[model samples]
Target: MSRPFLKMNGLGNDFVVVEARSKPFAPSAEDVRAIADRERGVGCDQLVSIEPSARADAAVRFWNADGEEVGACGNASRCVGWLLMEASGRDEAVIETRAGLLKATRAGERRVSVDMGEPGLRWDQIPLAEEMDTKGIELQVGPIDAPHLHTPGCVSMGNPHVVFFVPDAEAAPVREVGPLIEHHPLFPEGVNVGFAQIKARDRIRLRVWERGAGLTRACGTGACAALVAAARRGLTDRKATLELDGGELVIEWREADGHVIMTGPAEVDFTGTLP
Candidate 1:
């Protein structure tokens, strides 16, 4: 049997979107690995499946290129919102996920604005093994005596993340310390590592080392996490522009709603049939 799929990219973090509303198929790790293979398959950072929702909108399931299931994916959610709007002829949706429900609306022809809900900041919510006094904790990336980086604020946007504010995004040792901080002992389930360079109070540059997925072009959740971590530490304002490798995302932690609103573009690269 052949299944139709859409190739989409949310600020360069590409995804393979599959609609599983009618016919059901559970994608395995091997299946995801094959489909995400750059040379052999469609090649994407994540695979997104759209299923029937218990709420008014649809439900989304996110799978990494490695085929591991994830609690949430901000990019994939916007892509799913795009698909739902196209199929149902609606301009808005309230999609559901393991993390929580999100409200998505059409910002422009190709852009979607999503209310990503409140971020979790408590050490328990971030789910570190032990409690730390301050939101930021010191984790040695290289050597015990002299480490590469230390004292990163931890935040959870459905997934765990550690943000390191640096003087320069280019100079930050992402290649050397990303892998180390990703598997730091404090994070039992591991974490996404972000290096952020604040360009201004409202603009910042970011690079991420995702947990299941390595250094992707961009990570929406990682961007939100970075803004939250920075705002809490007084490094940046409540709202900021997160300039990622692929493109830029406008993120606002609204004081009125206390929900993080992420506005960005989602593109359909192509469509293919799964055989």
Candidate 2:
């Protein structure tokens, strides 16, 4: 038998969303990889499953293309939130995840805004191997005397991330250095790597190497992490527009409530069925 699914993308970070409320859909690591394979099956950066939830409108799960289950995905949450609102004819929806409950609302037209909750700045929360200054931790790459990348700010927006401030995001060696830092011994659970160029107090150019997914067009949580890291380091304001390869995302770290709001577009590419 086959199952109905939706192909969705947020800033070109695409996903294959499966509604499993009626019937449970549990795919193993191999199954996840196969479904994410561009040549053989439905291709996506991550696989999203929406199931019944008692605490929120629905419960969502995320699996990377490499097949590892993760706590949260900001882009997927926005996409799922849009789906729920459209189905219920409501403006807001709450989606639960392993990370926590996320609240999303329709920002405009095809845009959605999600409250990604407060970021985790403590080293233990980011779960670094040992306690250290999250603002530019002790790590480096390339020549010892003149490292290519070093002292990146760390933060956890549902997942781990390390942001490296660069003079030029486009020129940064994301592909070469991303994997090296992702598997760095300091981050016990691994981490997403972000290269950010501060364009202004309110703007930034960003790129991310997502954990397990490698390089994606955009990474919602990575954007949030970058903003928080920047603000903590006094590099940018609490709110900034992050320009990604696929598009742009507006991120606001609200001071009053200590919640990070992310607004972006979600597109329904097409609908299909699982083989």
Q: In model 2, which range of ten residues has the least summed lDDT? A: 140-149
Q: How accurate is candidate 1 locally (lDDT)?
A: 0.87
Prediction RMSDs, each to the true structure: 1.4, 0.6
| CA lDDT scores, all candidates in order | 0.87, 0.96
- Single out the weakest 10-residue window by summed lDDT for candidate 1: 133-142
In the range 109-204, model 1's lDDT, one tens digit per residue, is 988998999999888887788997336785656578886667888899998899988889988888778877778788887888999998999999
Q: Could you tell me the lDDT of residue 243 within candidate 2?
A: 99
Model 2 local distance difference test score: 0.96
Measured against the true structure, the TM-scores of the candidates, in listed sequence, are: 0.96, 0.99
Question: How many clashes show up per model?
Answer: 0, 0
Which residue pairs overlap in candidate 1's backbone? none
- Return the lDDT, model 2, position 236: 95
